[model samples]
Target: MTSATLGPLLAEARADGRALGAFNVITLEHAQAVAAGAARAGVPAVLQLSQNAVAHHGGELAPLAAALTALAHAAPVPLALHLDHLDDGPLGRRLLREAPEAGFGSVMFDGSALPAEENVAATAAAVAFGREHGLAVEAELGRIGGKPGDAHTPGVRTDPGEAAEFVAATGVAALAVAVGSSHAMTVREAALDQPLIAELRAAVGVPLVLHGSSGVPDEELRAAVRSGMTKINVGTALNVALTGAVRQRLVDEPGLVDPRRYLADGRTAMTETVARLLAVLHGAAPAVPSARALPADGISPRPR
Candidate 1:
């Protein structure tokens, strides 16, 4: 199977008035679960590898990226490989330059914390490189909540006027704007600003992404899609589910020492989480996303 790009999935979801679900991968099991869950849900989705995740894998990108690309190719549903939140440093620059070669279809160049001029200029350069290298670039403007400083308060929201100008200046394929979500939240009580989402959607020509979506409840997430969010990014929720399952498994069997036993259960839990979230993005709550048999080619029938 050929590798899938992020644009087609986002475009299809936009046309159907839904959103694309992008889940972060931490370990090999996490990547496997994403593929299995997307196949189970029978929907196109994205698998993301963040900078932190890379650092966890010994600060290397190639080995894991190749593995992720292989998984994306094997899935019958269209799956995209994304390098999420490339931090600003030498490692970030190296990753940005090697993303296409590493089999990534898209990358997010994070310059959100930089000064206004530097952010604009750096993002523009990344976007230009992306255009030449056949990779979609995502950029963030407003300072979202949960940045580990400033007391985790959302002091700045993406002004519609400013967002329009930023997109024009940077030429990004997608823009992750600040509405009301935060990163790495294990709970699900974050209330998104739907009105702001609609306003930003109207302001920017590119697709808008909602980062830190694990904290959002079902109804709020649905409303976010209705307000014109094209890509909904989820990271912490999968970890929460996996950890809970692994803990339970160990409790059930005290003598279980083999890593595979608990990790298998964790993988299953993550897969279920993926399928459930994909259903939310599809505007179909209470999704019947249980694992099912597929054809020999490992492709599930595409949603109409």
Candidate 2:
């Protein structure tokens, strides 16, 4: 199936009263794995590339964009390519300008680390940029600590009143509110404030987004969706799966110099992780059909 725009995907998820899984893609392999997982689960998914990831790959988003767009078209389920966590003002503006042309469904302009007024101002700018490009915009309201190469600082939970004002000021398509979830957490121990989420939902008209969701337990994740979160971003869990798989592969085969072999293992592990997350987002059992169940032509079988 061809990829759909982010607006429609999030709108549909909201209409259906379910949260859409937005997985972070750090490499070409990660993009493929996320697509394959969505195909296997027969659910729509978003493949996102963080600004940090783009920087890590030498500040070129074109290669990863091309790969994700191709996978989006090839997948059995609807997919969306998103530019995630853009912090640098100039680079963020450039990506916001180039993303729609490059086939991205959405762009998340993160200015959470900035002062409240600056964050609101910058996010409003990004929202305006997104409007000109006819692309969806996601802006962060509260600080979710744990950026790459940083010490883990607990997130300062978002104030419902502030969140409402921020969304109104920015005209963002989605609002990512911090409800006690932190980035890069390997353990599922983040305590979510459902009451805050509910309050924010009441205050903010747009869909609520939860970042650093990998640390949120399954129960909390489900509760978040029930409470009003429309988009949940997962990163650390996928990174854990990918790295662990690669490490195990190398340990099992000590002299393996081929990048493809280890990367393939990592991809497989990431795919499985995505499948489980999709199942949870869909509120379905995790035993979904595998990718192999898709027809040779790459179309998934209709549900019985």
Candidate 3:
């Protein structure tokens, strides 16, 4: 089935008081796995690619771009391709242009490392660019703690008033606010400020996005959604699953040099992880029919 735009899917989730799972994709296998998981769970999801992932593949967009578009076309449930955590100015602009042309539904312009005023200014420009191209824009306000590879960064927290002002000034489709969540945490122990989330929701009219969501526990995740989080960005969990699968596969077959043999297991692990998370994000029972249960060739699931 052809995937719908990310904006509509996220808007629907927000209106219905549900959260959409936004999983990061680093390779063709990751894209396929995420789409497959979305299909299995029978829910709308976002397949995002981080700037770090793009850089890993030699800074070229063609390979992953094609992979994402193809996966979207083949997905049985609504799927959106998103550009995640992009900080570089020139590269980000290129991605902004490439996303709509490649059939992506949304793009996130992450300028969190910059000062507050510059971050807002750069994000505002990115929001304008996305709007002009008819794409949904997600901007970050107040830097979230933790670096992608390095240890956590200290002294960054989002203010509700500043977030509201940022959203109003930038006109972004969604706002990612920092409320005590850090990125790249393998353990799910982060504490979320629920009252702050509610305050931010009241302050900013747009959907609230939670970055560094992989670090939050299931209960907190659900509570965040119940409070006001419409979109949750998950990356490290999927990475953990994929790496674990590959590692175990290699341990079972010590001399395996073939990429497909190992990567296939990684994909399966990722799919399972995605399926489980989709159910949680959609607030559906585990026994419910998943996206994978849909006819393998169907465009979309029948209306429930």
Candidate 4:
């Protein structure tokens, strides 16, 4: 039950022509649900903490990161902690410095807001920190379509040649490319450029990551993986699923008032969603361990 880095797992996925699911953690329930889902799928998954999630907690990442690390220790399947979509350079550096203490195995230092040259420089600095800490580094090239200002403008897809150069310059272990997916889309109707994805796969040496994957349909996701996307990032889908479950729970039991009571349904719903997405990403249902193999609370049995 020891915690481990994401390098070997991502590399294995790329080699096997399968993809890993990286779910975003919003609350303690989210951490449990993600781990539980991954356990059910019998596949390793990444549990990510986004910058917005940090803002929600008043910028204190240590508490959540500690909880995720503890949960990872007792997870039935391998789980890696990742800091996702980090745009602030100072924050990214601080996270990298404290990553070992927080038990983060990898990070996605997002510099997509910067011009290409600046993005490379900033990301390369993050990569330097990763080298020092022995944690995997993931950087994005081209804007991934979802920022508030880009709604009206055409999406900036990542070019294969540029992707190759970016990887070489930054030395990132993973590269997230824009191939028609956007962040925070509630509807699952994003149209991906499959040919572009294949081209990036052939051009870039590192594993390709697909961000804003919640907007993609099941078949499209499978196609993206088949086209060489090794890591798929999902956030909004879990939020929508959890919120819908909570709303239904409230209506079904009007007397319910306790947060725990309402949140239980959300946890269940998220767990189900995670399992389904994991199954789709892996392309088959893996044989999970028996119920007794997992901790009752889906967290570490050892003392925190």
- Best TM-score among the predictions, by candidate number: 1
The models' CA-based lDDT, in order, is 0.85, 0.82, 0.80, 0.84
TM-score of each: 0.92, 0.90, 0.89, 0.91
lDDT tens digits, residues 200-275, model 3? 8888899999988877877778889999999999987777777777877787889999999888888888888788
TM-score comparison, 1 vs 4, better candidate? 1
Tell how far residue 121 is off in model 4, in angstroms: 1.0
Can you give the lDDT of residue 102 in candidate 3? 73
Stretches of candidate 4 above 4 Å error? 285-304
Stretch of 10 with least lDDT, candidate 4? 295-304
lDDT of 1 at 257: 99
The residue-level lDDT of candidate 1 at 282 comes to 84
Task: Identify the superior model by lDDT, candidate 2 or candidate 4.
Answer: 4
TM-score attained by model 3: 0.89
The per-residue C-alpha lDDT of model 3 at residue 136 equals 87
lDDT of 1 at 274: 93
Give the alpha carbon lDDT tens digit for every residue of 1-304 in model 1.
Answer: 6678997778878888889999999999999999998899899889999987888888899999889988988998989999999867888888898899999989999888888888999999999999999989999885678876533365457789999999999999999988888887666777888999999888899899999898788888889999999999998878877787787777778899999988888888889889988887787657443222322232232221
lDDT of 3 at 219: 71
Query: Model 3 off-target regions past 4 Å?
Result: 148-156, 285-304
- lDDT for model 4 comes to 0.84
Which residues of candidate 1, in runs, are more than 4 Å off?
150-152, 287-304
